[model samples]
Structures are given as C-alpha cells and as structure tokens.
Target: MAPSDYPRAAIVTGADQGIGRATAIALARAGFDVGFTWHDSEAGAANTAAAITALGRRTASSWLDTTDLPSCAPVIEKLAANLGSLGVFVNNVGIGLNSSVVDTSYSDWQRILDTNLNGAFLCLQAAAKLLIAGGSGGRIVVVTSIHAHQPRFGFGAYCASKFGLDGLTKTLAVELSEHGITVNAVAPGEIATHLGPDETRHPHDIPRPGIPLGHAGTADEIAGVINFLASPAASYVTGASWEVDGGMAQMGAQASSHVANNDWRQATRKGTSNGD
Candidate 1:
C-alpha cells in the first residue's frame, strides 16, 4: 500500500446499488476492508461484494431494512464484527416520497420517517459506539439530499426527513468530535442513478437546463466526495455538509426532477432576461 493509504475497515449502509455501492467499492480501493448492508436486492449486494473482492480488498455484506428501526443496531454490530473493526461508517440509507403534506398518508409519512430518520439514528448510534470504544478515531459520512437544505413541491415527507438528518449530522459532528470521529454530510442533487431505463448510467444525456451544469450529477460523483470524507486526508474536516449539486443551490431553484421548463436555463435581471 502507498504511504497515504491506510488499511482500515469501513461500512456503508444501503449498498444495493448507486451511491452506496460506489462508496463501498471506493473505500475498498482506498485500502479499507469493506462491510456493506443492502436492502431490496440481494443480487445487487452480491455484485458490490464481487466488485470489492475483484479489487483485492476484503468485503462482507448483509441485509438492511431501514424501515425496521430496531433492526439497525444489530446489523451495524454484525458488520463491525465481520469487518474486524470500524474506522468509517457511511450512513447512506434513505427513501424518497413524492407527495405533499395534504396528500401524504399516515403510513407513508411514518415509513419515510422511520426509514430515513429513526432508523438512521439507530444505525449511526450503534456505529458511533463501536468507533468510540475502538479509540482510533473514525469517520462518519451521512448521505443526505439537496432537499436537506431546500424545499421541494410534492416531497414534503422526504424533505422533512432530510432536514432532520442534516441537523443530526451537525449534532453528531460536535458530539463525536471529542471521540476523534469526524461527522459530515453529502447532499446530492438529481443524479442519473434513478432517471433512465439504464438506471446505473451516470450523467445521463438528458436535457436538464434547470441546472447550471446542464445535466444531472452521477452516483460516482457523490461517491467521490464521500470517499474523501472517509479518508485521512479529510481528518481535520468535520461537522460540515457538502452540497454536491450542479450549482442548483446558487440559483435557488428546484432540482432537475422538479423542473420541466427551460426558462431556468437563462438568467433574469431586474425584469429583463439576461445572460448568454
């Protein structure tokens, strides 16, 4: 291994595919033994493990259903045991909802909260305990959404959950700083992972003029930031949220998923359309 590479153990939740899978593999490449948890598809989790093994890194995986909040702690403990120790934990389990508050059912709201917030709390808490006991200091990266800081139409439940998670990220950062655990959040805008028939395609060639970058971000893009956060290079960074949008936050506009018009592509100044 290179002098910069540290042989450690890292765990990522919800690695069935997309950003979580990308993160798990990236950490393996960074010289960490990886343990990942997946939900929905066992095949996808196997694929992730296979990729990590192909990298010549140690890997283990287990199932994770974030809606079952009580199940989170045990899964974390099991993964930590399988990996030998925990130096990094990426809290990457989340589910989205597409309904306004008035249109949302109680069940849907509860499920979103249980999965995205309550379950996440349990998982992070469990991981933090293991890390603190290890006494080696660790990294905790939370995967939030651009909605964590902004609001979107028809996504009341999801937005609320992410907002709460963002707050949790900050709180954990401060609380865990003393234990040498750096806590951070990665907030992604619309990524191509869920956009097309080829769901795994990155930066799908779709016309999304609403974003300054003119396209959606990719899972790998988000994973790149996460990989950095989990590394020794980012040892001094903590309690910060990295917004990985394509300049959407600067425009203060909706994400690509909520934009249907190309009007946002142009700049408007004092009632006059501006910008080339």
Candidate 2:
C-alpha cells in the first residue's frame, strides 16, 4: 500500500512515451496507483501499463490532447475517479516546435501555446481542485524544459510557453500551499526521445560535445527526479524548478536534473510527507 501520509494515486499527462512513460512506471514502483494519458500511441501506453502492472500497481489510462482546453479538466477528473482519488499529479503534456521570432506564424504560435501553456493551465487547475477537495496534502509536478529558464534562438514559442509555466509554478505553489499541495517544475536538457526532430533515437545515439555529461540523458534519469519530488522527502520542496540535465546548465545553454540517488529508481516503503 502507499504511505498513509500521502495519497497513493497519481496521474501523469502525455504518459504514452518519453519522460511521461518513465515517470508513470517510477510512480507505480513507488506504490502509486497510476493514471496516465496517451495522445497518439496506444502501443506505447500499453507498454507503460505492462510495466506498471508488473510492479503490482493498479493503472488507468485515457486519451488526452492538451490542446483541447475544455477537455483537460474532465479527463483529469475521469482518471482520478478511476483511481479512486488523487494524491500526486504530474503535468507532463507539452509540445515543442522550433520557430524563429520572424518565422513564427500565428497558427503555429497558437498551437504551441494551446498545448504547452493554456492546456497546462486547465490541467493543473483541475488537479489542484481535486487535491484540495480531498483535504489531504498532495504534490503537483510540472514537466517543463530548459527553455523554462534559458532562451534558445529558434525555439521561441516553446521557450515562451515554458517561461510562462515557470511563473505558473510559483503562482500555484503560493495559492495551493494552504491546501497542503506542493507545486514544482522539472526542466530537462537534451534527452533521447521522440520529441526531438530526429524521432525514436536511443539516448547515446546523439552525441553532445557541449553537454558536460558527454551524452544525452535517458528518460529514467529525469523520472528519478519526478519520483523524488513526489515523495515525502520532498514535502518541503515546492515552487522550485529542478533541472534534469547532466551538467548542461553549467554551460551558457545547459539544463539541470539533480537527483543524486539511484535508489530512487526502485520501490520501497517511504516515510510520511508532513505536507510542509
């Protein structure tokens, strides 16, 4: 069973693949009954579910397209209902499109914002309301990119959306504190996932001479931090952004993800998160 201090139920958005897939399985191993959403890949979602089930954890999934603002809350509610209740919510659904300031079309800009910013707002609001209604302390983790803090020339739309999320994380942290819900953000650097231009590549497939880690990170590396932030140990950690990059942030165009423990990858009984 999940620790009594926090709800064992968790919901992750865009969980069919990439970092989302890693986090869902991690939470399940940590004793969470996970609820996840898949946009385009039923096969990927099934693969994730198989892993969760193997851990002897209950899981539920739904189709979520963050660009549909009105659909966000209902989908969250449905997932929470399936899991019985919610304790931890991970808002990991977002899209990144490369467009320069001059090359950015109005339509593309809207598409990026609608998914990354506007859609995120609706989903986080819904999750927060559910946690508040439960009257028990909870956790909310947002998956942003390094763009949330630093700017890249070609990813204007993505950077703007992520920067907006950084503010949103702080705002929600303050607003939800009274309800015992801690909110934080995770900013990741180059990772091998389908999200980039070269889709479906392995972690070491792309070499990064600039990244201090010497290679791209895997989804599990970022998932490690997500798992920690949702644990009782991280109750006092809120309204902050943890970068999951491998020493990338040290450079002018770097990122951060600071979970130093490999133990986080495994499941074990955790202590009470006092909802500080």
Best lDDT among the predictions, by candidate number: 2
Residue pairs with backbone overlap in model 1: none
- Give the clashing residue pairs of candidate 2, or none: 243-256, 243-257, 244-256, 244-257, 245-256, 245-257, 248-254, 248-255, 249-254, 249-255
C-alpha lDDT of residue 132 in model 1: 91
The residue-by-residue lDDT of candidate 1 on 19-109, one tens digit each, is: 8988998988988899999886788889999999999988888887878777899999998998788889999988876676888899989
Which parts of model 1 are misplaced by more than 4 Å? 1-7, 198-204, 253-276
Worst 10 residues of 1 by lDDT: 267-276
lDDT of predicted model 1: 0.83
Worst 10 residues of 2 by lDDT: 267-276
Q: How much RMSD separates candidate 1 from the native structure? A: 7.5
